[model samples]
Target chain A: MATTAVAAPSARVKAKQSKRFKIWIGFLFLLLIAGGYFIVERLVQGLPVTNLSSITPWGAWIAFYIFFVGLSAGSFLLSTLIYVFGMMEYERIGRMALFTAIVCMIVALTFVLMDLGRPERMLNAIIYWNVTSPLAWEVHFYLVYIALLTTELYIAMREDLVRLAGTASLKGKVAKWLTFKNSTITESTKKRDHKWMKILGTIGIPLAILGVHGGTGTIFAVVQARPSWNTGLFPVIFVVSAMVSGTALLLAMYIIKKKATKQKIDHGMVVSLAKMMVGFLFIDLGLQFYEYLVGVYGLEHHHLEGLGTMMGSAYSWSFWGVQMFLGAAIPIFLVFNKKTGTNVNALLTAAILIVIGIIGVRFNIVVPAQIVPLFEGLPAGDYFPTFNEWMVSVGIAAMGLLIYTFGEQLLPIEEIQSSEKTEG
Target chain B: MLSNMLGSKNMTEKDWNNLLDTALPDVEKEMDASPFDTKLSFNMADDARKVINENLNIKDFHKKYHSKLLKEFGEEVGQDFASGADEPAQETDGVKWGMVIDLRKCVGCDTCTVSCKAENRTPPGISYNVVLEQEIGDFPNVAKVNLPRPCMQCEKPSCVQVCPTRATYKLKNGIVTIDNDRCIGCRYCIVACPYGARSFDFGESYEDEMPGYNDVTSPEYGIERGERKPGKTPIGTVRKCNFCLHRLERGEEPACVETCVGDARFFGDLNDPNSTVSKLSKSPRAFRLKSDLGNGPNVIYLK
Candidate 1:
């Protein structure tokens, strides 16, 4: 009688939860449909639809591209902290991190495709790799990194998938298809999968740091024409910032997903991860401070102009308002404050803000330097993403979310309760 | 159209030959006015056709005509023959094409910019060359200067260094060129170029302003790209001054160099010490823009 009384409320909650989930999916689909129209329009018209000119060849799409790449690199490295370094405290978030990395990479590459003047010929970058080109090497590296991520994620999910293959949910159906026919969740199979996960994650650390994100930074740093980006510290800052954004994204995702499903918030993990994310941010800001100091102290004209544009011109709001205040100061305060630091809700807001702040950072990185002309007398570039560009970015980002959402529903991205106690 | 097609389709080889015979002028009569031997001209023509068709080796043809041409043409062919004796196909070798612009003589008229547009048929927003005008000093003491900016065709081009597909490369003659067909239109080259010499062809045409603007595209790099249309090789790719490569091939100066109203532009082989550009490059007054970056710009400026 007591069990029936308990089951009744639980059933109602489950129904309510499923309905909410459907609405979320429907909302995303509507956005996708809306964004799809503009995506098609931009593709048909080509790059002229955007405000990008020869002077400012890259704009919002590139900023977002690098932003997503940073997220992917940061999250993958965070996953490595668990899988490779044996940090069991963060084990629950490991698969989700790997999955987010893959999703973010897809979004980043899609942005890159959208930015290309001739999107159809993108394979030419890969087919004819100029060995000296960091962009070419990055193209190859991103593919390898994606492949490595997928393999690691698959191995990480192996035991769960094998266990789920006999069940009747959508995830079970996917598990049946994804797993080997006679796959078993034996102790030996578990050990092998764990070993493989460790091996792949170990390889991924350097690949993510140097080949993926650092290489992306090098794409800007190697441009001697843009003195603001030409410093050696540029790539290092990129790796560090990736850590800041990555940890924040995972923290926010954990909280949001748990809230949506009405699960118990992992307060300890959230607080600890928030601290680590802030620590990384402090380091990122220090490096960035030094980077700007050296650039200003050098007193190079183009470099100064770039910094002026980023910090003192019309675009300065993005640098100070969004990147520093919202992205850094507020988050740092929230994470450190006595009352708010341990609060799950406060930490969630801080995580989301940092992610948004990193977007501002990315825009500051890509745009301001180009605003200062390459030559003294050449007309300086004026750029803003057209409505079409914004819509296309919206569409691409919506598409990534759809993939992640469906992937979560159909795969074992979330931690299985049975394995958690045993593993811990 | 069908009738025209059928008429040509039905014409036999013998009929075509007969028609060709009637259409032709009398070769002997035409040659009668010339002082040179008609037999020699006819023999040379046939052999030249053979050389063109690869039926006879050009070296052997040159050997056969060497003495006769020298005997007939005298001092002209003697000098030409002596100069052209070695490396007949390699005249451009050791000839690093460079341009020396005398800024003092420039009036900022933009004639070179105009002529460049007309010659290259570059669409709107795509100028291979532009004259940058600047005002120096504070308001009352200001002095105006006109700098005609063209592609530097650098020895170590940053564009070539950063291009992902190796689609753009420096040629043997020192002109940096683009394989537009291979360019993915990533525009990385534009960002990497310190001089801002490159422009992206946004597939724009001047159809609204002028009719038939898209009817012809300049045979840039001597490749006969048919028209300036969307989805074409150069339409969605990075483009820059190639020193008018096709014009250079035809033994003509770049349109900008030829049409400079101030007579400020000099185009010549920099490797030849006697060339005017070579001498100007050696002048203390001559300097390259952004020389500290080590691009080794072939475009020299004499102030």
Candidate 2:
């Protein structure tokens, strides 16, 4: 399989980017090595190596878990807009979104696994399926969602993969193996793939909303013990915040990749995406305001205490400074202000800020509510992730990035067929 | 005046007997007409008096009837009949288990907390039950209240509601139970419980200094998970008070109730109005933890 592909000299030619590619590979290798060290340390010492306690049972790991789940849900939702709803304007990102959704889910589930006390028994969740548990349902949902994402992604990339299979480059060789030797690209196949994508993406929308992200929120909201998290509106807020982070991530990734590759930036698309990102942010903030207002107005001691911890306590900086000021305020202003709104650089900044801000948002959601104890005498938790926990998180994230980079390099993720046909 | 409207004085033993006889006529008739069991029933009725009066081993009565009843009915003969190993599975009456903790009687001695640990042999980070003591009001106006908290064992348990795998569930009888083997140790149930009744077993233990702490025994869900080893059945799972169901199965109260120095905790069937727990549950001072949340907590407290 490896040799036959290397023997071919086809119409597709390679460009000389070896030196730059080698340097990038070196950097990624360094990250992987460093990350591997921390991952090992965490495994050996157990969760005690992290600063987590019973009070703040979840900290950065749980925050990161929800963040990635949001990314998966958001990307899948965006893909639905393209492939399912037939939004032709957004066709370019369809396959990429599906792939991103799948990868993000892997990352999310990995974070959950890392956070567990017994990682070896992870399969217990599947082996003993408890239908009543939302977490159990999520485990099943994730497996199904990943399967759907994989099938949808394969279909979305099929034609491009078939086109690449005929070329002589390493990527082409990889693409050839991806498609069975007898697999042909035909009009009917295209139509069939399109029909399936629409069906899967359509089905995926509710599954992403109700089963994945909202269910993630239900994991928190249903805990009537935590007053800050115990509200009907909480899950809705989670869905909205997911959109905020997801759109920002895709927008940032698209712009950064296009700039890096010296490809033409779709200014109109960039502006529209930024507007959509901010639009979700506003709705997210509005929902949060009402949520906070209701919590504050009720004067329930625990609820107030939770809100206080988020807004006025030591970690309030994360809520006000990171979540609101950096994540919401700056991005909203940059996207809406006359001088910055249309500028691509400014929009990119806002998108990046929103992405980072959503991290703060996720952290605030998990930590502060826990900071306020269930009952008064039960010690209030004090937690911030240790250096080891932070490093392991970074390492896991780098591992995900490496997977994405290698995936893009090997697969026909880009819309090459459409571009070539349009050129003709 | 309000008591006069619902006074028990107007009711007699005959009236109570008639009420029971009418409510459960079939069982009563079975009792009256069992020719093969006539002498035994009459003796049981007589011994039931001495057993209540002289405190005879109820286990003896159960042993005497265990075989005969199995031959005739293929099952146990009483409502609260949790017998030999197989009996819990054949619980035909569908007991909705509940616990009533009288806070007014609690002295905050942490006996329930210690007994729970001793009974469950919980690891360092996990306590299936704990007593939460808090002081209300300011300096001069303050009252030191000892609130011994066990799981509320809610009828609509939030932990059960949000559990993705349904590893935790509300039993037919009100007890909320966890299937530890199935749990992912995700601690979702711990997070979701309103009572904070649940705890995650982080696998830390007293085995390093305390000999045999890790050697043997974790009688969880009535299955003895031998050895307190790390990475075992309950090590990563979520755990909470099951009203000491294993002990309850042995016709005993929960460890917390049994060990409470103040005699504050009462364990019984809330379904039985004549049970000490039910009558105590109706006292004017009766209250529940977080009553406003409407979890319908089976654990009632006397203020």
Candidate 3:
């Protein structure tokens, strides 16, 4: 798919691209409608429409919530590497990362709303804050983090938004609406924008790590009843895994979007980013290894039971098949292999696989510990998300992609075109 | 009431005492057995009865008892008395209700579980109480231990700690209560509870088996919710044992405690050192389930 897209003639691609976007959007709309039906059915009937029970109160929705939150945190932190730390080596993808972070956060919160049994009352989490609850803290942190991300993205694109304000294009209308009429690409304004981006990015670093993603990990880790998640290392592991997923997603997105538009792929940046992603994965795996080893060695019954449920029980296939082989080992081999390591298509494949693998990681984290009943002699939870859950997830994901696609077109999400850039 | 309405309000004080004594012969007998003056006990009990009925000021009773209690119990009780005994009444009056279950005496007939179901009127998938039957050892050496489980109502309740909204909270009486109206049905409390005490109300009903099952709710927490309906406050929210709070408000024991056939369960105010529950809780034989986790479960069990 990557080769064909890259090999396509520019004139033929341009003719078909507009129609393709329409068809893609139409397909996404159908999925959204279908999923919306189940969403409404769930709301009206309450939680009974799904297979969720008291035994496993959280299901696929929770897993996806954490998955997207991890993605958002990871992507935001990656943008910090470019804007804050001045790693201009990978500057081309900086705006994309920030935009992806925003979209991913929207998707993550949608998943949370879907999972809520009383979604309308969700604001109560804010109104009546139980300061002890990690979940409550996460709600507040997510809001502030999203606000910071939007500000950073806006500052990063301010120069482009100003430059495009005079054009007759659709993007021009949006650029005019977004920027002040007097906005200009002067050296002073450019300097001001850069400074603000740096400041926001610097603030965002801790917000993404400790407040967003690490706090998400704390939601699970603080549950003393689930000993496997109770370790201090759990939040650290979550931060590392976020880096892994974020880098992989951005690398894949950059490659796909470039190939679709028949633009030049920055081979040096792709290769280096892929290497960094795998590096983060290795660290993540090492931390998880120690987490498991310590948990097993301590011989706590529930911890052991949780590990057993994840690795050896009926749920083990997801652990070994999706997360380890597809998510880790194969991606590592593809990135490290001599012939394929430098290949753009292989790296893209590796990136996509890692994203899927992290989804498996999320499911493994949420479901296994719950499967082991809280007490001995009690019935263990048996959970598989119903068709309604899958539909809701698919719909929410399509909504995120649609937003990203339109965002790319309407805003200067890409490095502003060279033709347009020369004028500015 | 009809006689009073007919303007025949000329009952003498002696006549009223005769009527009260006749109406509650059992209470009269119990109060008479105590060594302290029975007249003072009756007077205090009479004032407390009026207080429960909301007919008299509770502060008036406290003021009346301040000097009398000091005079009767002597200087030993002075410390507690002098510390503003005239203060307005407390919400449960320093009572931390707890339970002690003797495993040796429990026959595991599941009477407590059944009574809890009947009293709470929980749906098919939800039970406020359950007796877990676990077999110890292996083969011929096996011994069965029936662990009757209910909400621990912990001093530091894990559910209360993790609740996103302060919907679920530990009342002053030590019963952890869920204000269903405020609950968002996030189920974080269910996930956090170490004892697995909480359940999501799925709006399921025994209506198919017993007609009108959804007609009326059990007035849990003394709030009279009329019907069991889909997507109601509790239907989408979480539910758990509030130690039969409605029954407690009526000055009656929880249905489970009342129905324990083995007499294994003992319920009283743990804050009162003289209460049976407090004494049993201190016993070397008494141990709480997973006490080391530091939730400080109020439910104690004796081997």
Which numbered prediction scores highest in DockQ against the true structure? 3
lDDT for position A170 in model 2: 85
Please report the candidate that would top TM-score against the real structure.
Answer: 3
TM-score of model number 1: 0.86
Report, for every candidate in turn, its global Cα lDDT versus the true structure. Answer: 0.91, 0.81, 0.90
Write down the TM-score for model 2. Answer: 0.81
Residue A306 C-alpha lDDT in model 2: 97
Q: Write the residue-wise lDDT of candidate 2 on B1-303 in tens digits.
A: 637734846877887777677777575567777655665666768878877775776666665656656665555454344444354543455555666777767888898899888987877877777777778899899988887778888978778776655678887778889988777667776676667777876668787779778887667779888876656677667778888888888888888888888888887888765788888889898888888877889988888
TM-score of chain A of each: 0.96, 0.94, 0.96
Q: Which ten residues in a row have the lowest lDDT in candidate 2 chain A?
A: A1-10
lDDT of 3 by residue, B198-302 (tens): 999888889999999999889999999888887776888899998999999999999989999999999999988789999999999999999989999999999
Ranked by DockQ, top first: 3, 1, 2
lDDT tens readout by residue for model 1, A1-424 = 1122222236778899999999998988888888899888878877888999989999999999999999999999999999999999898899999999999999999999988878899999989999999999999999999999999999998888988999998889999999966898888888898899989998999999999999999999999999999999999999999999999999999999888876666678899999999999999999999999999999988889999999999999999999999999999999999999989999999999999999999999999999998876799999888998888888888899999999998999987752343233
Per-residue lDDT over B172-276 for candidate 1, one digit per residue giving the tens place of the 0 to 100 score? 889999999899888999999999999999988888899998988899999988877767778779999999999999999999999998899999999887899
Model 1, native contacts kept: 0.79
Q: What is the DockQ of each candidate?
A: 0.54, 0.37, 0.56
